[model samples]
Target: MAEYKPGEMDISVQEKTFDGFISMVTKGAILCILVLIFMALVNA
Candidate 1:
């Protein structure tokens, strides 16, 4: 196993807030696509 020195202990972890942000963006894009399709169907 590799070890990091005390000052060089660069750390990385999946932040909980990041999950919420990604979910919000994904949901927004899906919602926008659905709305556009609905409009096209109605206009046609």
Candidate 2:
């Protein structure tokens, strides 16, 4: 049976997930703003 200390792995995975989530959210927000600006320019 493979064994690992769950506590350390859990913390590592949680931090990685949080970092990825923040990056994705930031990128999504920027993309949304860019799209909105493009739409506004097109409408103008």
Top-TM-score candidate index: 2
After TM-score superposition, the amount by which residue 7's alpha carbon in candidate 1 deviates from its true location, in angstroms, is 9.8
* Regions of model 2 farther than 4 Å from truth: 1-10
Kindly report which residue pairs in candidate 1 clash with one another: none
RMSD of 1: 5.7
Summed backbone clashes in each candidate are 0, 0
What lDDT would each prediction earn against the true structure?
0.84, 0.91
lDDT of 2 by residue, 1-44 (tens): 87877665547878899999999999999999999999999999
Candidate 2 TM-score over all chains jointly: 0.76
Model 2 clash pairs are none
- In the range 7-39, model 1's lDDT, one tens digit per residue, is 665334455577878999999999999999999
Q: What lDDT, from 0 to 1, does candidate 1 have?
A: 0.84
Per-model TM-score versus the true fold: 0.67, 0.76
Error of 1 at 33 (Å): 0.2
RMSD of 2: 3.6
